[model samples]
Target: MHIEKNTFSLIEIPKIIDEKGRGNLSVIEKDGVPFDIKRVYYLYDVPSDAYRGGHAHKEQLELLIALSGSFEVVLDNGFEKKKVMLNKPNIGLLIPTGVWRELENFSSGSVCLVLASDVFNENDYIRNYSDFKLFVGA
Candidate 1:
């Protein structure tokens, strides 16, 4: 893979409002995107001293949003890096494949929701920092 260094584009998650206060909310994912949702997970009651998601996917794309409270997403694409603070529910960061990311500095009572395009596969994940650097050619 090529060493990529740039700010990845952000995608807006489609929100379905609750009607009549009898149903739940939903987020829809459309086709034609680089990735598709295959698994869903969330974090709740994260501590301020704990850091989450310190890895990169080789082929899977991830979307992260701060449902409650606040947090920071630090993205690194080999030569360049950027940090985005998310506090809104409607806005989210679109993390493309082959980029290293770290979700950290979460406020108490923070709920971080992650939508993945692929299921959990250890081979698809670059777990080691040196491996991530080597994969990005940094």
Candidate 2:
């Protein structure tokens, strides 16, 4: 997996609508998401002023989706920075490894669902900005 450090993309999942409202499903084995699903988690009931994800992963890849409400994701590759707004249930943001990410501006009652490529490993995280910059040779 030779992923570019600045390579982040939005993937659209198919939504089904019928007489009984609407719903969507995301399958990791399908092209809807790029990695093999290993871990799944979600964040909800966040304060309007609260923020999450202030670090970069060394090898873990993730897909972040706004299941409800809205939020902003700020990504930095140690050289370039980008901001993306996630406000749809059927849309996801692919976060590759070696990129710094921050999630903020979350609406009240927002739910952030994350699909991870690897299991939990504390050693794979770069929790400090200074350390991340040095690691990426910024």
Task: Give the 10-residue window scoring lowest on summed lDDT in candidate 1.
Answer: 1-10
Residue-wise lDDT of candidate 2 within 94-120, one digit each (tens)?
999889999999998899999999999
Q: List the residue pairs that clash in candidate 2.
A: none
Question: lDDT scores for all predictions?
Answer: 0.78, 0.88
TM-score of 2: 0.90
Query: Which regions of candidate 1 fall more than 4 Å away from where they truly are?
Result: 1-7, 14-26, 31-34
RMSD values for the candidates in order, in angstroms, are 3.9, 2.0
Query: Against the hidden reference, what TM-scores do the models get?
Result: 0.81, 0.90
Tens-digit lDDT track of model 1 for 2-74: 2233447665666667778775454654642346679889988878988888888888877787888999998
